[model samples]
Target: MNHDTDAMFRTLKPAGLDTTVAEAHARRREQDLAAAWDATGSGRGVSAPAARRRMPRVLVAGLAAGAVAASAAFVIAATDGSGNSPGARPTASGTVRALDARAILLASADSAAKAPLTTGAYWYTRERETHFVAPMKLTEAQQKEVDRKLGTRLKGKTKADKSSPVTAWVSHTQESWSGRDRHARTIVGIDPKIKFASPADEAKWRTLSESQRARLQLDVPAEPHVNNYDFSHAKLLKTDEEKQVSALAKLPSDPAGLEKTLRKWYQDERALEMSLDGRTSENSFAAYVFGEAQDLLAGPLTPGAKAALYRVLAEQPGIRYLGTATDSMGRKGAVLALGTNGDDTGPIGKNFEIRLIVDPRSGRLLAQESGDRKAPSLTMTYEAMGWVNSLGARP
Candidate 1:
């Protein structure tokens, strides 16, 4: 394996974005609490607004899908007014100017309250992930280690850190479906061909022998891998939607019970990803839960469950509202974001932001994305969701 493969592997793990979005909001709440702390300590209140953050530039490619329910296209333009995106557009002030983040979410909750439950034989969701790679050099020892692990000799000229770097851009399409019966399928692979971002990188790749490229996994002919899962009973899928939605249906529509249940679910998922305990502070756990809520939406969500989700998010701190913009699928929606700085162990070890895109008109979620100024970013646009009578059917 070359430096590119090493870098890609490094990027395949869950990172600080999960914490950042959660922590960013947690810090805001802390500040509010700290104001009371200050008053108690010095007999005077200290007021400070959370720092305004800038959204990173994002490049969303066009999406094309075969027969599917709901919308198929996904596209998100940069909201920073940087003019760096082809999808960027000036926000129309007349309609959205009066709406704040909380107002937007409240409206969303109202919309969700009226939404209907969907039932089908299968639930389908299609999305795309784009990875941006920069030029990198690999040492000879590093190349040998990669070769040893793969049991194949890499045929590339090895050089130290000072050599010319090679880089490529790639995108992957992922499709997943869960059935009302007892089956689930996920297909993931690079859909479009990989392209060298820099012409110099392209030239460098062309200089390599075809065998070397194959060993390096630099060729675009590779197929994406598929993973299939089947469950004999819905109880086996109880970790997520199956559990949460079912619980929501039993709980009262009041916010307190709703919040407690959702928070418990968040704690459960967080425990799976990281170690935490009674002493562990709940810094952006709510934000993390907000991000995770989309997965439940892909399944069946009752109107009360949907409204509870929006209401919980409306109360969370650190959610920044960016006026309407198009997701990668070309659907217009309002954008809310939270994030934190990336560390050495984190994937995309640069500062990144996680954004939730919600349909402004219907208050339905459209997409979610995590991106940074450097390194690759991931955006998941929900094309179509709902139950179908059969595996291949769409609703």
Candidate 2:
């Protein structure tokens, strides 16, 4: 196995509750990870569509995840690190096919690489410096705030998600205590309005049956709002155009390009500077995105300008197509809608539109607009979209 893979396997784990939960909350603050769960065109798509209009009432199913920090049996990576198994490949496609029940647990072994963590190599790295990670004491007052923000109840969630009142522990490297003691305890719960029509609706939910409330609040609403449409499924509905599952069975064996943009768009030093203040709320969110986007989305592109597209889109999860359009740079671009990867998938109120401009001829990005994915998914409407001829049409 490659040295990186060996090191990755040796260092990774699901992480303690404080680490996992913090990682979740931190992802929310980054522009890219914030969009992952939405139906818009992922980093691979060409256009930005408008967010669908949604009804005032919407169903919001909550999600949470957790991991117990264990030594011994849990420290190993993969079902067995036997030679070049399928799980070793980092391709964005079907690496999961190799996993059976045993591999599933091993699959999560590296889940620790994601952000909202503040240890090891996590504190300072490239464009990800926009994210911050520096271990600090979890105070009593701070724990409550974390619970309030997690906004996704963990009762049915994962172990870290379920660990309540937030107990935090740290093993202080493999040399530290080597037993079942927790390094940290973390609890997560849904925001008050996450399900109800509004805060007032929350009151009504308390009076409603648990199943009734769960069912009513979990149905993704369908309104005229642009955010309501799932661009991933749009072609299937026939209401929109068709976009086939990627013809490339697996994202290129060794995709490239993302590192360039992050290096260019957000200077590494500045991003790192942000990390220097790791205790701030913004640092947590930034760190989450840095870690998640680094491995989860990066390194799967074909190359050149397309690589840049993959980088931006990989980070912006809820982005979708808004059809063809010209950009401020006057390069014709395919507009894509944007949304927050937030639990609410229905109509997102306010600004939530993200746009990307591509050179129609070279397929290079000319300009970009990353907006909220709620209402106004695009700053430019579908009709307003067109190709920009840097060369004159008359000529």
Candidate 3:
């Protein structure tokens, strides 16, 4: 990536934005990513034309924005060239026949519909998030600027060693406890660790002060930050707090009815956006519905409603089954890919793919991953989720 793009990525602070503003920022970021990828080739056999293919506008928009809006798409592909439909099932002869995406999702929906409903004082969730940073060389001017900003000079390397870049991964644990009465608390433990590609990289990293490292988005305080939110007064989601909580049980329980209700909501939202901005993209309806479904899944919902969401997902286009895989937490589940031609390349760039791992038996989402198939750039794993009696309690 270019220096400007890298700097923009490092400086993004979306914590303060409302839902609408955050979505706008997310769109701009996607455009920036596409532009950056175009300027600098991915060198992964993905041609410019293929990489620039107009994927569904809102593919994974909800996941990218870290908000409760529209989410990504999932494609369907046949595993054994059988061209099975959504109701297809595995063979009974003990021979392993890979099931299609629709079948997997439909089965999950059935399981979800049977789940027992429970209530508690708070809806709690624990998640682990990881972000991978690739190595990139910096220009001499960039290096000097960083050094000056940090008030330190490199130990050696007058000019020749600027070609080296560092490789590292940053990760953190996030927990949330939300109550139906519009009260919520979120805690984020920012733990960033760096692994140098070489001794030179390590030396360069070691020269920076702790504050400087934090400024560069390389380090953060060891302590966890807690934030309290009063949803009644906050503009968080598209709907108000009362509706958001009430819809958990009030949403349609049948697939067709649920889809219809969600479509109406999408149309109303778009109409409002068009009236305000004079124009709104019409390609994001599917993404918006999926995003809403995802958001509802994170909260307490009736089993029928949850199952309806899975059925709705099964009905989408371009969903492909990637077989089964283990999540970041080492839990095995069925995997699905979206917005791709059954390859690593997609609208984002070469070696990048949007994937979701779902637990079919329990009809729960295990993880969402984006980037390289071997090593994704971002991975969000659901460690635990359920109703708890108190804020700090786990499932």
Candidate 4:
């Protein structure tokens, strides 16, 4: 859309500027977004003058909608204060002042988190994952669930002093019953790079953070309520540096039936794309895939890891199994063909594309790509979205 997709994505963050005002603004924004979305159909959109024939009505409408929702247009034109909202000011990154997810959550506990649930407490779902990293040790109640997720002690660890790279105990619970029908999902994490002066200096933050803090309550809003929250604020890291992959590597290298896991991720990413496609956006098939996608993405690769990778690549959407092959990187990776002509994928007919190249030696998405926007496809380089300093070459 004419509205920079990146900017639109930013507006969807856990907002707290105004509760009542935010909701009203949010509803109108959703409508504008939907209308803007309608204009992007491969076809079936409004006609444009010769000068703008290539652009869809959706793009134009989305720009207008975004301006209304943000309450002000973020013109690409020069600005003095970077891009942060007025009065909110901007950090070096153009976001609010520094403080990683870890510190922010701890400080926000007394303010944002409600009683019984406790402040600094949050429920997270990463494709069925219940584990999270924290900056501090876990509280007794929080440790129970963390232990449940870890499935065992940290190999000779004590309750008082456990050796976790990121030390913190967080909770994950399912609220089976609620007074209201709507569901509530909150995920709050920390990012050490945020750099707080010290506990005392940081302690005063809960008040300074009145605008950005998230409340641990049921039924906030998002067209699709993502139960996932990146408490780590690690989006800045490149794929090669993501903290979890190596941790997965530490697990038993000899994995059996790894196909199930691989296929799960393929299904998850594929289904998610389709659901996001807006055609079958409401189907269980898509939802089911998303529900399991994250579990499939992460791991302590068991004896079943490699096989799972092969199997999933064997069935990934827009992928054609080209049989076993090696990549230019010389990693013993498999090659998968992307695009509608894929024998296994049939025709998505959408303009999207995908490429999954893995290191067969270690079942990992060494490099991948996907998306309708060709310059920097969604494939594997999430570093796109222009968030990073560079957008690596696409295969």
How many clashing residue pairs appear in each of the predictions shown?
13, 61, 9, 28
Q: Give the candidate order by descending lDDT.
A: 3, 1, 4, 2
lDDT of 4 by residue, 1-395 (tens): 75789788769855664676756643433333223222221211100011101112211121122112222111111111223221122333333432221121122221211212111112112210011122223345434433433344454655323321221112122211100112223322211112122364244433333332221111112232224223243443232132242333332222233433334444554554455442222223322222222233322233244333333333334333332223223333223334423331222223323334332323343333232212111112111010111112111
What is the TM-score ranking, best to worst?
3, 1, 4, 2
Give the Cα error of residue 127 in candidate 4, in Å: 18
Worst 10 residues of 3 by lDDT: 43-52
Candidate 4 segments whose C-alpha is farther than 4 A from its true place: 1-300, 315-318, 321-333, 339-349, 379-395
> lDDT winner among the candidates?
3
Candidate 1, residue 64: lDDT: 9
Give the worst 10-residue stretch by lDDT in candidate 2: 123-132
RMSD of every candidate to native, in Å, equals 18.1, 23.8, 18.5, 26.9
- The residue-by-residue lDDT of candidate 2 on 109-132, one tens digit each, is 222122121112011101100000
Question: Candidate 3, residues 1-395: lDDT per residue as tens digits?
Answer: 69999789657956455777856643443343223222211111100000111122222221122211122111112122223332222343323333567767776787798899877877887776655443333345544434443345675754323222334445677788877766888887644445444576577767768765664445645789888877756765453432455456577889998888778777776676576556654335454554454456656777898899888988877566765555555555666666333333423333445667677777887776554445444556677788887767888
Point to the candidate with the largest TM-score. Answer: 3
- What would the TM-score be for candidate 4 when compared with the true structure? 0.24
**Which one wins by lDDT: 2 or 3?**
3
lDDT of 4 at 250: 35
